[model samples]
Target: MDYQTLIVAVDGKVATVTLNRPDVRNAFNETTIAEITQVFRELGQNADVRTIVLAANGPAFCAGADLNWMKKMAGYTHEENRADAAQLAEMLHTIYTCPKPVVAKVQGDCYAGGMGLVAACDIAVAVEATNFCLSEVKLGLIPATISPYVILATGENAARRYFLTAERFSAQEAHRTGFVHQVVAADALDATVADIVKALVANSPNAVKEAKRLVQDVAGQPLTAELIADTAERIADIRSSEEGKEGVRSFLEKRKPNWLN
Candidate 1:
């Protein structure tokens, strides 16, 4: 699909979605958010796309909301503001629950709503020099929409401090706080993301999809006997299925799996 604020490229099994507004550090406006929501839906339906990598074409991955856009919205009525915020919230949810695995390739500073984008990804890799901040408080605004995803990525304790302070943190700190998955040299960002994509692509698509579902299915749920029995039954069914049988046979024969071969 053609886009004005973003670019989409498909190569083999990987789809790369690039934020294209480099002049403003790829800051998101309403159009950009709308495009992202539509693009993710498109890629989710594409059979050839097994994984998606979100990156940007500038010094920073994203600087979050467009200040000018926010300024304009300051005069909007309560109802109008609700509608506008809902658009962004829905877009973030689209990426968060995307069927295909979403990976973030962050190169530089990510602030405010940009951090929500990172949190929405299933996995994220950041350059060593990359910095992160949840700076809405600095502008006398709150990160209302991104709160759920950010809290999921970073626990309440970390969020409490960072959200209030809006202080910039290092890539390592971001990883420690559970925002970033890995940190590598800026020059090696591509290689690192490629390696991760390779690893993800080597898994059974069905299994990966099921596992992603499992994470959400079991989250915050009690481990009851019925739940355990249900899980066991599900695994037993998969073990007797074609993909599972092939996986076992390939392992026993000391050969590469179907996904790799």
Candidate 2:
């Protein structure tokens, strides 16, 4: 599909959705938000796609809201403003809940709303020199919509500091806070991301998809009979699945799984 603000490509089973608006540092305008939501929804339902990598071009992964878009929002009434914000919130949610494991290949600095993009991914690998900031508070605004994912990524304590201080932190700091999984030199970024992608693609697609859903459904839930029963049922259902049976047969027979072939 053609997109005015994105470059989408699929190689084998991996689909990459690159933010192409480098002229504006890939900032989020209404159009960018809409395209991201649309593309992710399509990719999530694509059986040929086993994993997705969210990437961006130029010097910044994303610079948050476009200056022009923000200017337009400045005059919107409360209802209009709420509606506009909802688009962004839903876009982030779509990425967070995508069935495929989305790995963020953050090759540059990320800021403001960009934080939401990184946080929504299942994994993030960033360049060592990249800087991250949550500067909404500096503009007399709050990171309201992105709060859920950001908090889950960086923990409540880290969010309290960055969300309030609006400080620009280094990639190491982001990794330390668990916001990014790995931080590598610029030259090593692509190799690192490719390695991660390769590993993801090698796994059983059904298992990988179910694992993602498992995490979402199990996290933060109280440990009780209901929760235990639910988890037991999930494992049982998967174990009885064709893919699961083949996985066991392949392992016992010393061969690659059918999916890999």
Candidate 3:
């Protein structure tokens, strides 16, 4: 689909969604947010797309909400503000729960909602020089909508400090806080993401999808009887499926997996 603020490209089994608004550092407005939501929803339903990459053009990955958009919203009524905020919230949620693995390629400054986008991705690779901040509170506003995704990415303790302080953190610190999966030099950013994409593409799409769901199902759960029983049932079902049989057969035959081959 054609978009003014973003670009969507599909190559083989990987689909890339790039934030194309660089003049304002890719800061999101209502139109951009809605475009992203619609594109992600489409990608999620496309069977040919096995994985997705979220990247942006320009020196800054994103600067959060557009200043002009914020200015326009300043005079909006409470009801109007709520509706607008809900749109942004739904966009974030759609990306977070997308079935296919989503990867973020962050090469520059990522602040506010930009940081939230990285947090929502399944994997994120950032440049070593990249800077991150949760600067919502500085403007007398809060990162309320992105809080759930950010808190899940970074723990409660880290979120409490950064959300309140609005301080800039380095790429290493972001990795430590669980936001970035890897950090590479600026020159190596593209290759790093490519390597990760290769690894992802090498895995079975169905297995990866199932694994993602399994992680979600077990997260925050104890090793209770019910949990164990649930997991056992899931495993049993998979083991009885065609994919599982092929996986075992390929392993014993010392040949490349069908998906990778």
Candidate 4:
């Protein structure tokens, strides 16, 4: 599908979905949110796309909701506002639950709902100059929709501080908080992201996708006998699967797996 707010490109096994509204600091509106959801949904189903990189083409990665969009919302009724927020929530969920791994390539400022985008990714690499903020409170709004992913990425303690303060934090702080996996110089951003994509694509696509699902499925769940049994069953299932058997056989033979070829 065509998109006005995003630039989607694929190279080999990696697909890059870039927020293209640099003029508005890539801040999202309803249209932008809907487009992002649709694009990711498509890419997630494409067998050729092993991974997705969330990126932006602006000095600011994203500044959250657009001013005009917010202005339009100010006049919305309570039910209308709920419907609008639901779309944003679904969009974030789509990225968070995508079967393929997602890596955020953050080069500059990321804020509010933008923070949601970064938090939803499976991995993130940010430039040293990048700044992140959950500034919704400052605007008399809450980071409600993005909270599920943001809280998971940033942790409850850090979320309490940042969510309440609405203060800007550095990329280093983001890395420290575990939201960003890697922090690199601006010039090295592309290389760093490429390196991660390389590692992801080299792995069995099915296993990588299953691994991602495993994490999401098990995280925050209490350890129980049923859970333990479920995990055992899952491992057994994968071990007997075609890809799993081939992976082990190739490793034993000291040859590249079919996926690598």
Misplaced by over 4 Å in model 2 are none
Ranked by lDDT, top first: 2, 4, 3, 1
User: For residues 70-173, what per-residue lDDT tens digits would candidate 4 score against the true structure?
Assistant: 99999999999999999999999999989999999998899999999999999999999988999998988899999999999999999999999999999999
Relative to the true structure, candidate 2 reaches a TM of 0.99
Model 1, CA-based lDDT? 0.91
TM-score of each: 0.94, 0.99, 0.96, 0.98
| lDDT over C-alpha atoms for residue 72 of model 4 | 99
RMSD of each: 1.6, 0.7, 1.3, 0.8
Clashes of 2: 0
Model 1, C-alpha of 211: deviation from truth (Å): 1.0
Per-residue C-alpha lDDT of model 2 across residues 1-261, encoded as one tens digit per residue: 799999999999999999999999989899999999999999999999999999999999999999999999999999999999999999999999999999999999899999999999999999999999999999999999999999999999999999999999999999999999999999999999999999999999999999999998998899999999999999999999999999999999999999998
lDDT (C-alpha) at residue 128 in model 4: 99
Clashing pairs in 2: none
Q: What is the per-residue lDDT of model 1 for residues 1-261, given as tens digits with 9 covering 90 to 100?
A: 579999999999999999999999999999999999999998988878889999999899999999899888999999999999999999999998888899999998999999999999999999999989999999988999999999888888899999999999999998898888999999999999999999888887777777777776777689999889978987997888777888899999998778765
CA lDDT of each prediction against the hidden true structure? 0.91, 0.95, 0.91, 0.94
